[model samples]
Target: MPHSLPPAAPLRGRFDRFLILGAVCLAGFVLPLNFTGPPIATPAIAAELGGSPAALTWMTNAFMLAFGSCLMAAGALADGVGRKRVFGIGIAAFGVASSLLAFVPDLFWLNVLRVVQGVAAAAALSGGNAALAQEFHGAARLRAFSLLGTTFGIGLAFGPSLAGWLTQTHGWRSIFLSSVVVATAATVFGLPRMRESRDPAAAGIDVPGSLAFTAMLAAFTAGVLEAPARGWGHPLVLAALIGSGLLLALFVRIEQRSRRPMLDLALFRYPRFIGAQLLPIGTGFCYLVLIVLLPARLIGVEGYGALQAGLLMIALSLPMLVVPFVGAVASHRVPPGVLCSGGLLLAAAGLVWLGRADPGAGWIAPLLLIGIGAAVPWGLMDGLAISVVPKERAGMAAGIFGASRVSGEGVTIALASAALATFLGAGLQAALPGHAGRVAEIAQHLGIGDLAQARALLAPTLDPATLIGVYERAFGHLVDALAAATTVTAVLVLSLFGGASAHDIANTHEAPAARADGRPERVADCGAHG
Candidate 1:
């Protein structure tokens, strides 16, 4: 039986809903800030901590892998244990971990703390929608979701800038300290007032399934992250990749057989659900590629500081903020598939335009185009994803969506890193052909015999302008690759849009009696309805 919402209680007021939204949004801020802060401060952190190139990569990738892998388990746990309680605990733990990071003495300890932070972040990110879905209904629900999207957009936009400023002024420690304060405040305010929202009929925790899924994700991520350091054929990396495949196979089998599976395999049977999930995967792949490439191009290639790089990236966020309103309006009149497809196309065009940008080109035009293009897809994807699912299963639906986005991002970054290494290596090898022996010696000294190693060796021999030129050429290759990848992804998403549109049209024409989950008949169901 479906879990029904409680009758409209006079005690549940607008203020309560606002509190829930505010708390969730505040908690959401910490994770993005933690994720972005290190990237902006990479140079500084690496300098102080005596880290190699690989260590720096771990600082960011560890959080991503942990956050992505644990999301499904966190979602099921939220539904079983209680949304408010899980969210509060997660927020508090994140605060504690972030605070500890402020005093981390070495890169290893920092990575350890980041993994803990990631776990806490998974808890908060997973439960956020379920909490909102439990609190508001109808237009209020729509408004709350819109606000949540806006909060996420703002966080992504501002996180790097905040990190840049703090890293420049007070050092990287301040970034973690700031996260501690923000997370702590959210946990404090949210604990007493946040109401519990759990479906009593949901099955018990799927411990075996969760373990299998986690192992699969961990192994897969480790393989991706290690590919650059160890050749693709390295035994440990190969073994991890093979083990991940086997675990994933086992996970699917378990889900099929378990009475209380963490994932409901049946959701994929709905074309609308499948389309909704794919939208994020496509968007996430493009988004991370752009996010990582833009900063490296601006700061590393163009010799910009952390602040300048962050400011340049703000172009990506500006459009993300404004386009959702367009999506919201479009959602009311246009079919979601039409809006989503259009948004993705626009974003693809923007990335293409960005790829064509010259090293010294005026920044405003490209920035404007990217802002507009990126915004459209960001505004509409989440709401559209949830629209297809039954309201009672919103938590699971959201969990799946979040997992797709996170996993896509992780894979995208890994691929982009590999591509970047290849391009950078080619450029370095070409630029210093006759001096290969000397370059190799320098690379050994620098402990970076990769493409970046070659570039560093050539840096000392070339003039400042020529060094800049070499980096620009290398970075351009990455931009082109990202654009091509994004375009392919956009085209695929457009195809999904067609399928989703057909589903929406069928749903629209169907009689209310035919609708599953009794959504059309119930008012309370509308509030917490995904």
Candidate 2:
């Protein structure tokens, strides 16, 4: 049986709904801030609390991996329990975790706390969004979600600059402290106004499926992040890589057998669904990786101050604020396939252009171009995610889509970061022939935007200018590779999204649901409901 809402009369009014939207938006805003802030603060964090290259990477990866892996489970938990209850718990836990992060003394504890924060975030996001959905209908829901997206964009747009200012003025720890305040406000204001709701038909949480998927993601990410430090052939690295594959196979088997699988393996049969899933993964490499890596490059290799680097990053993120709305409007006239695939192709070009631009004054154009291109799919992916699935399975589609996007970002950043470290180390080895053994250590520092520490590891006779040049070259190569990858993804998405009209797909390949006349029931397009 489908879940049903309570009587509309007592649920909420216009003002109350707006209040709920505001509260949810507040909580939602912090999530992007958490993601974008750490990379900017990374240099300062390293300067104050030392960590290994992999450990430093974990500061960000731990949060993302935990959040992504737990999101589907968190959604199910929210639906199984009460949305308000889970939302409040998540917000309170997030505040507490963030408070602890502010006082953490070492990298290990900080990473652990970040994972806690991530799980809290997953709960908060899943519960908050679902609760908000219950509060509005039709056009109101569309507008509410749009505002939520804008809030997230604002967070992404300003998080780096805000974090930079805070890091420069107070300390890296202030970033966590600030997030705590946002979480607190969200909990205080949102909880009372929100009524409790749950899915009566929701099965218990899929523990086995969740565990297998989480373990697979963790194993794979560990292999990727550790590989450059520990050679690919190292026992642990090999074990993690092999174990990741085994876990993935096991996850599929588990899901197939489960009465209520977290993911519907049958959904993968749809080419359009696969294409929709690719949108985030494509942007993950072309845009999300750059969001983390660019600030480090500006601060470490190009010798920009944290504040300067953050300000420069605005060019890349600002388009997210407005271009998405434009793309959403443009979708009325143009097919989404063109908009999505074309946007990625444009971003790929921007990546190539960025690779060639001078580090200082020449960056804004390419960054803005990339931002504008990536924003299109960013805006439309939610609708596309649901449009490709059966109407009854919209929630499942959304949960899986969210997981894919977040998990893809975590995995992509690990791979990109490792590749960057390898390239930088190789460059440094060639630049300083006698210091090959220490290049990995130096590259690790440089990779996190700790140029000062990286310099200390080098010979006093070696010019700082040579190291900067080598870093620039390595980064350039990485950008070129990202562009190539994005181009290939764009082509694949184009092929996948083409060849069939939505009507044809719905008529021919609709789920087993049938009409009274023995005809297959047509699946409605997401836009029709919106």
Candidate 3:
């Protein structure tokens, strides 16, 4: 059933407050469950399905690609049609997709199912975030967002250990089934208690803008993910890269001209908004991109079991638990710009320290430092995405925020994974000096990450010691690259922050409300619609 929009009203809880908070928690929990859970299961999935490294990358990227591409459109639909209805449908669809995944026959089907799940996620996640911004206000709004932050933190904290133990004890398929159970429970808890809400002023969906955005993201993602296997100069890959650029230019042109654009290009005028959008890219580079690789590094290279590897990942996610509390204090006292700048600086430094780690005891400190630095700043950005805009546009703002963060994670993962495979291949060629032909075959095995099998295959052709040396060197360089990316993000964010503190800029640049005739009003009155 579809939800209908009524006249605009003050932001208030039409349902039980506790139920509202509970539903928001569920939405937040699912974010990391979908993204972070799969990495823990990747090794097991690859072994069972015989997926190539590129195929395995698609298993994750396909979902993120769809999620990022669909987010703004879904958010716009929620604003015009109904937030609760769209959100409930998304949750139901997500559960169905996860159930189907348990029975997916091959890697191809698995990737397709993941895309479906990602599309569903865009609705539920953005709607839930928008709902929070629409319902709560003042201190309660701050508290609600903080709770939302902790929920995802808990999800990321639980994902690795839970997914690893489940995959090891049951099988890789159990991971999908587990997600089904969680999504079902969230749907049940949310639908009945959730209130229907919408922006009456919202224009109809911008079909061209939506299609163009989706195509642009899809082409770009395919280009990056396939470039490693198909050479960078391959015809299809080159076409995708060029096509994505053209689509991006087209999307920009459309937004600039559309009467009611899906993405309001005016948002970019605020330097603070631009700065807020960029922070997610940093988090994706410094934190999420690394999480995806840690399990492979630990279980594949260091001889740890799945469960043990999952446990080791706790060092990175544990600090996430305290993020909301850290965020609460920072949001109330410090300027957001200052907090973000300082936090990213600390995070970049931590990543540099982590890059130099030698597969030993000293690795723990930098991991914890990076985790804290990344997670705490993330909490500040959660509310700013909605708060910076007029209350009527919360859904739009939430969608863009979701797109930025999810797309950053998706694209960064592809880049990181591509780099990992390329470097490893070069290292193997060096290690297997006399066996040039065998090097290619061994590279394929290692690239897809059947590392134990690669070791076995190489033992007959080269010295075992030399093979281990190659892995260590390749892995060290990958971490160095990740460190470099984070440091660059830090420097860019610092420049974008400019001179104003977050508190000052946010107060001065609050989005103006639009009149019925589409003229802008100067009131900063949040109680009017937000």
lDDT of each: 0.66, 0.79, 0.74
Model 3 poorest 10 in a row by lDDT: 521-530
Give all candidate RMSDs, comma-separated. Answer: 4.8, 3.8, 4.0
lDDT of 1 by residue, 1-530 (tens): 34454453344666766776788878766676677667778767766886767677778778887887777788778877887777877888888898899999999999999999888888887787777777765556656666676566567666777887888789989999998888877776665676777755466567888789778877887786666456579999899899999999999999888765667676565455555665655555445556655655566556677787777677666666667787777666666666665666666666566666764346556656655655666666666555544555556656777777676677677767765555544554576687655633332222221234435555645555544555566556665666666566666555555533323432322112112342222211111111
Which run of 10 residues does model 2 get worst, by summed lDDT?
A: 521-530
TM-score of decoy 1:
0.87
Query: Per-residue lDDT for 106-172 in model 3, tens only?
Result: 9999999999999998988877777767678655675677677678667766688778888889987
For TM-score, candidate 1 versus 3, the one ahead is 3
Runs in model 2 lying further than 4 Å from the true structure: 1-11, 138-143, 387-395, 499-530
Model 1 lDDT on a 0 to 1 scale:
0.66
The sequence of per-residue lDDT tens digits that candidate 2 reaches over residues 346-401 is 99999999999988889999999999888877776655664454433334544677
Clashing pairs in 1: 133-528, 136-527, 137-527, 319-371
